[model samples]
Target: MNAINITSTEILSDSWYTLKKISFEITANDGTKSTQEREAYDRGNGATILLYNRSNKTVVLTRQFRMPTFINGNETGYLIESCAGLLDKDNAEDCIKKETEEETGFRIDKVQKVFEAYMSPGSVTEIVYFFTAEYTNEMKVHEGGGLIEENEHIEVLELPFGKAIDMITTGEIKDGKTIMLLQHALINKLMG
Candidate 1:
């Protein structure tokens, strides 16, 4: 294993989240040392969940406009994604539950944490916790469109499980977290 030492960190932006340029030195196993610098966006960690209904073969999702996606060649800028939110002062499970109700109108009491991952390790310092939950129409507490105070205008979508799966291949669903959760559902036969 290579030994790493963080030499310096400079704050680049702190308007919304934090963006820092970090400088470090690595001493390799072969006795070679090198210095490197990289910028990392720290939006903190987050949690995402897929709400599936086995009887109805449906899943709850959200559609929202993402500026990064729009500037990166996504013409429409609207992305279909699993319900997710940053774990501000809450734990992963609590964050997901709050996010699920706020973003998708589903008040899920039980969620099985499937996994956790660094969605973009190269430039972002966010490890997202992934979860899955079963939902029914009775769980819908309100018409979810995200929190207005947060400037989030999410569109709730209840799509057929099979259609959601097909959207991945058709490029209709491109959100990384959403794809991962949907694939998890498919692989685990969650709809059955």
Candidate 2:
């Protein structure tokens, strides 16, 4: 039996992504029902990738300004994160590959999918596909800083895997997806 039945959906905002207020009725296991309304932000699905070099024990990351984090407490508003992009009309693999080249300048032909996750399940309707790929200096074709028309000014950083891991404890790397990928690398020994 379905526990939730959506009654009506109201569009709150569509200026950027879509923000909707959804009203629903949920039946509890104990034979109780309650009406509720929740706001969900739908920005479509995305894919993120960690580019690592096992020989050098290094990982590639990008730093960019995030307006949301700025207002929420990030003094600089810049976040270091894995290369990621919205799926748009492409599949997860294709999107991540394109994002990797655009954000990190590394044109990787092969990628290993790590997992899929909902970064925020409470309100956001986005599931991020996580991937990892081995990279080398020869793979870099250009200086990647994201799309100019899109107004993305990304700074690329290549750091030692160990140093990147330590950044997690020092609060230097705070993005959830980046942290998860780093931890995944550490746990799976992707560096060594």
Candidate 3:
């Protein structure tokens, strides 16, 4: 296999997040080779899950404040998104399960892997694991709104699947992962 040789990786920032500048020699598709340098943001990998109930015709979601959106264009900084979090030290499934409960207050037992994607490939190195799970009223055990210590003040939202899907067109939901999961559900006929 052809390989891209990494010559050097220099740390540019080491605060809340990490940024590294690297020089690498890459081979083009036409068999040409050249050296390039670029900075990459390493926030680590994460997982996202969409909880849906076929019988109830509804899905679970979360609303939270994202500073990046506010700075970019949103005035309130609030976003409607799927339950997600960084993988930390656990595997994708485990991380998604823990995040689902912590942020939405629902403990899920079984989850099926839907897909995996790289949300941002230009500068950030984050590979996200996408999943969907079936849930019922019996699965909810706690009042979920995220952890105070983690500074997560999330709001749990259980909306009709159809309505939530329509939200995408109306611009109510803006998160990428949420959009993908919603479309997946529609295309896969996850709802009854």
Tens digits of per-residue lDDT for model 1 on 1-192? Answer: 999999999999999899999999999999999999999999999999999999999998999999999999999999999999999999999999999999988888999999999999999999999999999999999999999999999999999999999999999999999999999998888987
Please give the lDDT score at residue 67 for candidate 1.
95
Global lDDT of model 1: 0.96
Off by over 4 Å in 1: none
lDDT (0 to 1) per candidate: 0.96, 0.97, 0.95
* Cα error, candidate 1, residue 116 (Å): 0.2
Q: What CA RMSD would candidate 3 show?
A: 1.4
lDDT-better candidate, 1 vs 2: 2
Tens digit per residue, CA lDDT, model 3, 99-132: 9999998999889999999998999999999999
Superposed model 2: Cα runs more than 4 Å off? none
- Residue 59 deviation, candidate 2, in Å? 0.3
The RMSD of every model to the true structure, in order and in angstroms, is: 0.6, 0.8, 1.4
TM-scores for the candidates: 0.98, 0.98, 0.95
What TM-score does candidate 3 get on C-alpha atoms?
0.95
